[model samples]
Target: MKSITLFLCLFTYFSASAQESCMTVENIKALDAQWEEKNLNPDPEFFKRVLADDFVWVHNHASMIDTKTSTVKRAEKQAANEGSDTRSRIQSEVKVAITGNTAIVTGFTIVDRGPTPTRYHFMRTYVEVNGTCFLTGNHTMAIPEGE
Candidate 1:
């Protein structure tokens, strides 16, 4: 009786864990863009939902490390300033990999703020819990002003 119960418990645990699935690369990419664009309109609740509690972002030029709270505050402020007005981010060299419940993505973004576009290289990490994915870390570096 004890052996049968232990076997059943282990099977139940593994079955439950296996049932949990992560988001696809395409889905994750869309989600990333959505969260970033939210900065323009600044949805505090959405930000809270998309970002992990310990989220961290390393800025490009300023090299400032931003926590989740600070990033959300900046987004709110940006919305107060009438938003950035940049909606299109053309991504190049994009790649996304998933391992278990975590995903790592690397890409370059061409930000079209005006006639002259700026390029940035970025790597972002996400993790899924209970079928929901959240951004955990983001590191970006400005591509030098040249080809």
Candidate 2:
């Protein structure tokens, strides 16, 4: 009876942990969707809630930007682009690996806009700080054709 109880306890703990990990992945996925819909729509409050203060974003073009200021700047730049006026859709296949309070998410995003389509493979690392999940770093690479 004691062994059975111990097994049940361990199973419950692991099951709860697994659920939490899944929730974290879903949160990150939702954030990606929010970013895709309108980068400008993410407020500073949201950034504070989701991104680490020292977050570094590495763009596919090899430009590196700080998350805090760059979040707004990126939105502004996107707004200025002619492509902003066109409707674009992004689909991502995200795989998240969680270790303690930190998580790494790697995925490929395919974006379609009118007659053009682009694909980006990206990896983002996130950490839980002060009881909130924050994006710490990111790297993106463009996938060549025929891969």
Candidate 3:
């Protein structure tokens, strides 16, 4: 009886952990929405919760690289200078793809800060770690003005 009870307990624990590790499209979409919201309105807690400690972001075709610490600092700075610029952005054509414990999200965004809007293409990579998802990597490319 003791042996059977221990086996059942182990099985139940593993099952729960497996379920928690599974990533769905809806989950990715929700996370993506949170990322977008943070971008528009900087949230330090959101960044801390979602980004991995070693997270790295490459921007504008590698013109800039940011680590998790740098990102948080930049967001803090942006939050401080909030009223100086009227910048807002909208994301579109977003798609999520999952493979094993990793997910890749790609999208296009248009930022309106002035009379002319600038467009960008972005990709974010998320990895499941101990039943939680964290943004591990990010890349962004600017779309040329015309085509």
The numbered model that scores best in lDDT is 3
What tens-digit string does per-residue lDDT give for candidate 3 at 7-82?
9999999998777753778898789878877888887778888999999999997899999999888788878878
Instruction: List CA RMSD, all candidates.
Output: 4.8, 7.1, 2.9
Candidate 1 residue-wise lDDT at 78: 72
Best model number under TM-score: 3
Per-residue lDDT of candidate 2, residues 22-79 (tens digit): 2376776766565555542434445555667687888877765556677755555655
Tens digit of per-residue lDDT, candidate 1, span 18-131: 786657898788887776567546777788788999999998865699989998887777777877667667777878999888999898887777777779898999999888
Q: Rank the candidates by lDDT, best first.
A: 3, 1, 2
TM-score each candidate: 0.76, 0.64, 0.83
Q: Considering only N, C-alpha and C atoms within 3 Å, which residue pairs clash in candidate 1?
A: none
- For candidate 3, give the lDDT of residue 13: 96
Clashing pairs in 3: none
Predicted structure 2, TM vs. truth: 0.64
Each model's number of backbone clashes? 0, 0, 0
Question: Model 3: runs farther than 4 Å from truth?
Answer: 1-14, 82-86
